[model samples]
Target: MEQTSLNLVAIAVFVMTLSALLSPALNISPFIPAGTTLGILTLATLDSVSWGGRGLTIFLDLFATPQQRQRVIHHEAGHFLAAYCLGIPITSYTLSAWEAFKQGQPGLGGVQFDLTLLSDTKTIQKTPLIIERTLTVLMAGIAAEMMIYDNVEGGEEDKKNLRAIMRIMGISNSLYQQKESWALLQAKNLIIRNQTAYDALIEMMEKRASVEACQSLIQEKINQIEVMT
Candidate 1:
C-alpha cells in the first residue's frame, strides 16, 4: 500500500460514515455505506492473504497521480541500477504492490539482489568492501528519491535493513548517522555518474522490463557515456 494499512482503513471508514450521513439528503441508498465498507474489507482480506494485497494496491493506486507512480519507478531504479553497476546480480524487480505480489515478494515494491551472495555471512565478514557495497545499495533508493523529490517518503524498510547490517557488524549506534550520510553521498554520486543509464533504467523499470534486458541496456548506455566522455 502507498499509505499505511491503518490509515487507508481509517480513510475508508470516514468516507463511508460521511456517505451514510449524507444519504438522506442526497437520496442515496442508506445501505450503500455499509455495503461499500463490507465490500472493501472483503476485498482487502482476500487480496491480502491470498494475493499479497495486490488488488488493494491496484484500487488505491487508481487514485495515485502520475507523479506518485513516477516517484516509485525512480526510487526502485536507483536500487536496481546501483546494484548492476557494483557488479551485484539483480534477480528481479517490481514497480507496484500487485507486481511484487505476483513475484512473491513480501513488500509492495523493490529491486531484489542475488540471495546467494547476500546469505553468505562468511564472505561478507572477510570483505569489508561487501559492506560498503551493501550500504551504498541500501542508501541508493533514498538517495534517488532525494534527487528528484528533495526528500524521501519511501525507504523505511531500507533504513531498517541498514540498521540490521550494522548490528551484525557490532557497529556502535553512535556512528549510524554519520555512516548513513556517507552512504547516501556515495550512492548519490554513483547515480550522478551514471545519469544516462539511470534515466534509461527508469523507463525500463516502469515497464517492468526483465532483469536481463535492463542489464543489457545499462551496459550499452554506460558504454555510450564512456564514449561521450
Candidate 2:
C-alpha cells in the first residue's frame, strides 16, 4: 500500500518536471526533482529485492498521517473480524509496517492467521467449505475497503495470496476469477451483516488493544447483538 503511494509520488514528480510546472513560481533546484526521482526509484528497487521493502515501509510510516494509519487499522480489522467469524484463529495483527517488522511481516501488515491448517487443506472434493472460508478471509480486506470507500485502493497482495493458494490447490486460472468474485461477495456480506461488531473491532484496534482483548470484546459485542436481534 505504501509502495503504491510512493510510486505515484515519483510519477507525479516526473509529470511536473515535464510540464514545467515548477519553472517560474517554484524556482527551486533542478537537481531537487532529479535527485528525488532517482532516490525514490533506487529505494523502491532495493526495498523490493531486500527485506520485502521493510526499510522504505518503516520510513513511510514515520510520516504517515492519522488518516493513513486509520486506513491501516481498518484494513487489518477487516481481516481480524473475518478470521474470527470463519473460525480461523489469528495469532496477531500489526497496523504499521514497523510493527509488522517486529511481527516478522515487514512490509506486509495485517492479521496473522494460524495458517498451519492450510497445509492440511488439500484439493479433495470434501474440502470445498474450507476453501470457501479461506477465500473469503483472504478477500476480507478488499471487501472492507469497497464497503467504506466504494472503491478499493489496496488488495493487490490479497489477490496474489489468493492466486498462490489457488495454484497450490490445483485450481485453473479460469476458475480463479469465478472463485475470487464469489469470495469477495461473501466477505462483503460478512462484514456488512456484522457492522456493530466490525466497528467495535476497529475501535479496539485503534486503541492498540491486545489480541486477547480484541477477541474478547468482539465476542462480547457479538453476543449483545445476537441477543438484541
Candidate 3:
C-alpha cells in the first residue's frame, strides 16, 4: 500500500523533472503545470516499480550511510535466509540503492522470490503453509535488525514494515499472527546458522557492490547453505 503511494510520488517527480528539463527547448509557456504533472507521474511510476518488487527498494537505499546500508543488508539477508529455509526459491536479489533509485522505487533494499507454492499440479491446500512462510519471511528482516541493533531505528521505513505486517495480520487474522511468531523464530535460527554469509553480505553492501555482484554473492551463499543443510 505504502509502496504504491511512493511510486505515485516518484512518478510525479519524474514527470515534473522531465517537463522542467524540456520546457525551455519546447518554448512552452505553461511549463510549471506541465512539469508538476510530469513529476507526479514519474513518482507514481517509481511507486509502482517498488510495489511490483522490482528492486526499487534497493535503489532507494543507495543514498543511505554505510551503517544504514549495512543494517538494510542484514535485514534483507534475514528475509532471504528465512525464505530459503522454508523452501522458497529466490528469483534474484540486489543490494544497490542506486539501482532502485534509478528505477524510481521505495524501500532501501529487497529480495525477489518465486511466489509459487507447489511444484505439482495437484490442488492440495497449501495456503496455510504459504501464508505462514511469507509472514515469517517478512518479519525476518526486522528480526535480523533487532538481533544486531538491539532495536530498530524507528524511521518511516520501520513503520512501513510494521504496517505491512499489521495489514497481513488483519487479512489473515489469527493465522497470520501465529505464522509471524514462527517466522521470527525461524529467522533468528537462520541468522545464527548463517552468520558468515550475513557478515559477508554486510561487507559487500558497505563497498556499494553492484546488483550483479550482490546477486552472485547471495547465490554462492545459498549454495553454501544448501551444502550445510
Candidate 4:
C-alpha cells in the first residue's frame, strides 16, 4: 500500500514537471487539467488497492512509523496464528496492501486459509465446530489490534466476513454481535497462549516465507506447543 501510494505520488510529480516544462512551449496551462485527472485516478486506484484505503490505510501506509508497521504485523499474525492453531490450512499470507490489491482482496493484507475442509461446498450445512472456529479466526485480527492499540479500525473487512458467514449460517444480528464478542474473546485467549509460536511465525512471514514453508513451520510450532503443554 505504501509503495503504491509513493508510486502514485511520483507519477503526480512527474506529471507536474512535464506540465511545467511543456506549458511554455504549448502556450497553455496544463497544470490544472493534469492535476485534476491525476487526482481522480489516484483516488480511484487507492480505493481499489486497499479495504481501509480512504483515510485509514492510506495514512498508515504513507505516514505510519516502524512501530506502526509492527502493529500491522501483529494484527496479521493474529489471524495467521489463530487459523493455524484451530487446524485451518493456510494457503498463503501477505502484509502488503499492493499484493492483496493485485490478488483482488478487499483487506490491506491477510492470511489466506483454505476453508474447503470445513464444507465441500459453500451451500453445505457447516458443522457447529467449523462455524465456531471460523468465527474465532475471523475475529483474531481485531482482537490482536485491540490488544496492542486498545482500539482498531483495520478489521472492517474481518467483521464483514464474519457477518457474511453468520448470515449464511442463518444467524440473526443480535446473535451475530454476541458471536463476534465470544469469537474475539476466544481469539485473544488463543493468541496469548500461543504467543511464542505466533511470534516465530510472524518472523518467518516478515521474511516472506512461501506458503508451504509457512504451513510446515506452523505445524511444527503447533506440535511443539502441544508437546510442551
Reference-based lDDT, each prediction: 0.83, 0.81, 0.62, 0.76
TM-score: which candidate is best?
1
Q: How do the residues 91-203 of candidate 4 rate in per-residue lDDT, one tens digit apiece? A: 77777655666666643667887887555435436477888898899999999889878998578778998888888777888897899999999999998887777778778
The window of 10 residues in a row where model 4 has the poorest summed lDDT is: 51-60
- Runs of candidate 4 exceeding 4 Å displacement: 1-64, 102-107, 117-126, 227-229
* Candidate 2 C-alpha error for residue 60, in Å: 2.4
The TM-score between candidate 1 and the true structure equals: 0.86
**lDDT tens digits, residue span 114-222, model 3:** 7665322232143556655666676778788889999965234533453464464354554545655666787677778777776776677557565457556766887
Name the 10 consecutive residues with the lowest summed lDDT in model 3. 117-126
lDDT of 2 by residue, 88-122 (tens): 88899888877888878856578888877567645
Using all chains and alpha carbons, the TM-scores for the candidates as numbered come to 0.86, 0.81, 0.53, 0.71
Tens-digit lDDT track for model 1 on 88-171? Answer: 778888877667767877656689887465566676677778788888999999999999899998898999988888777778
- Worst lDDT run of 10 residues, candidate 1, spans 1-10
TM-score of 4: 0.71
C-alpha RMSD (angstroms) for model 4: 6.6
Off by over 4 Å in 2: 1-47, 121-126
- Per-residue lDDT value at 117 in model 4: 54
